[model samples]
Target: MHELSIVMSIIDIAETHARNASSSAIEEVELDIGELSGVEMASFDFAWQQATKQTLLEGARRQVNRIPGKAVCLDCSASFPIRQLYDPCPVCGNHLLDIVSGKELRVRSLIVV
Candidate 1:
């Protein structure tokens, strides 16, 4: 699945950074996954385990920090949390909310030793 490729990419990036620091091995890979990022957390975790099976990150732990989706209303300047992509602003009840957060999937940090 696509998660395999995504996990593979993550491993590659982490490996590069870990090597740069001269770390013996990567202990953990931390990720910030926004709620609206369209990534299934459990699937990603499973894919990560499968993808890193023979790589340097084989036993590396993955820590996911889930970020809630948020939006700012352009009409009322109100901010609200969104559960889905098409969710309207809770305060203004408007669809003109500008997305301020979420829709992101990236590595935030790592622990190496």
Candidate 2:
């Protein structure tokens, strides 16, 4: 799964930060993953379990914040919640949308010690 690669990248980032901070281990990690970010949560969890072995983040507590999708109708300038990609604007039934949120995939914070 692509989540494995994502997890690997996260580990790289965490390691870089921990090394820069002169920390021996990462205690916690917080992530923000939005619904529209194309990540499968179940697959991500499995990948995380497999990827963290023998690393600084091996024992780190992880927290994920799920961000709900939101978009604005380009035609009507109306904003509404979206459940999936390419969802039409609820107010105008238009496909022309400007995504306002819910495409996030990032490491929000890390606690190293």
Candidate 3:
């Protein structure tokens, strides 16, 4: 699954940073996986459990912030919260929207030691 690859990438990044800082282990990791980011948290958690074995991120504290989806309607300039990518604007009922957030998938921070 793609989640496995994603977890591997995260481990790689964390390890690289740790090594760059002259550290051998990561203590914590913070991530922002938005609602519209298309990552399945269940699958990601499972992959993380398997992928972090013997790695720098093993036993690292992981904090995930679930960001809510938000968009601005192009037709009426109304901003609204969305649950899905195809959600139409509630105020103007317009399909055209400029997504302001909730598409993020990134490692926000890492604590290495």
Candidate 4:
């Protein structure tokens, strides 16, 4: 799964930063995963468990902040929450939209020790 690759990338990023900062271990890691980021939570968790072994993040406390999808209808200028990218606007039932958030997939912060 691609989630495994994502976890590996996260580990690589944390290790690189921790090493650059002269830290021996990572104490905590915070991630912002949006609803429309296309990552399944169960799969991501499983991948994390398998990928972190013997790595710098093995003992790190991970905190994931799930962000909900939100968008604005372009045709009706209505704001609403969206669960999918193609979700029509609730007010106008229009397909055109401007995504406001929920496309994020990034590491927010890390506590290195």
Candidate 5:
């Protein structure tokens, strides 16, 4: 699955950073995953468990912050929370929207020791 590749990338990044800092282990990892990022949480969890073995992040605590989807209606200038990518504006019911947030997938912080 693609989640396994994602997890492997994360492990590679964390391990690279830890090695650069002269740390033997990573204590914690903070990630910002948006609701619209298309990552299945259950699959990601399983991938993480499998990918982190024998790595610096094997014992690291993972903290994932789920960012809610938000968008602004272009026609009505109304802002609203969305659960999906193609959701229409709540106020104007318009299809044209400008995404304000909730498309992020990044490593926010890492605690190495």
Candidate 6:
């Protein structure tokens, strides 16, 4: 699955940073996953476990912070929460909206020791 590749990439990044920082090990990896990031959390977690099976991050914890979907209505100039990408604005019921969040998947922090 793609989550395996994603987890491998995360491990690579964490390893690089840990080595650069002269840390003995990685304690945790923090990720910001938006609602519309198209990633499966369970699959990601499983992939992470498999990816770090024999690495220094074998015991490292992954802390995922979920970011909610948000849309800014272009018609009403109002912002509201959305559960889907195509969801209309709650305030104005407008389909003309610019998505402001919930489409990102990024590493926010790394805890090494």
What are the root-mean-square deviations of the candidates from the true structure over C-alphas?
1.4, 0.7, 0.8, 0.8, 0.8, 1.4
Q: Which is the leading candidate under TM-score?
A: 2
Per-model TM values vs. the true structure: 0.90, 0.97, 0.96, 0.96, 0.96, 0.89
Whole-model Cα lDDT of every candidate shown, in order: 0.85, 0.93, 0.92, 0.92, 0.90, 0.85
User: How does model 5 fare in lDDT?
Assistant: 0.90
> Which tens-of-lDDT digit does each residue in 9-79 have in candidate 5?
88888888889999988999999999988899999999998889999889789999999999999999999
Give the per-residue lDDT digits (tens) of candidate 2, residues 8-95.
Answer: 9999999999999999999999999999999999999999999999999897999999999999998999999999877998777999
Can you write out model 1's per-residue Cα lDDT over 9-48, one digit (the tens) per residue?
8988998999899997888888988888888878887897
| Best candidate (score: lDDT) | 2
User: Candidate 3, residues 7-96: lDDT per residue as tens digits?
Assistant: 998988888888989997888999999999889999999999999999999999999999999999999999999998889999878899
lDDT of 4: 0.92
RMSD of 3: 0.8
Q: List the residue pairs that clash in candidate 1.
A: none
Number of clashes recorded per candidate: 0, 0, 0, 0, 0, 0
Model 1, 3: alpha-carbon shift in Å? 1.8
lDDT of 3 at 75: 96
Stretches of model 4 off by over 4 angstroms after superposition = none
Regions of candidate 5 where Cα sits further than 4 Å from its true position: none
Model 3 scores a TM of 0.96
Ranking by lDDT: 2, 4, 3, 5, 6, 1
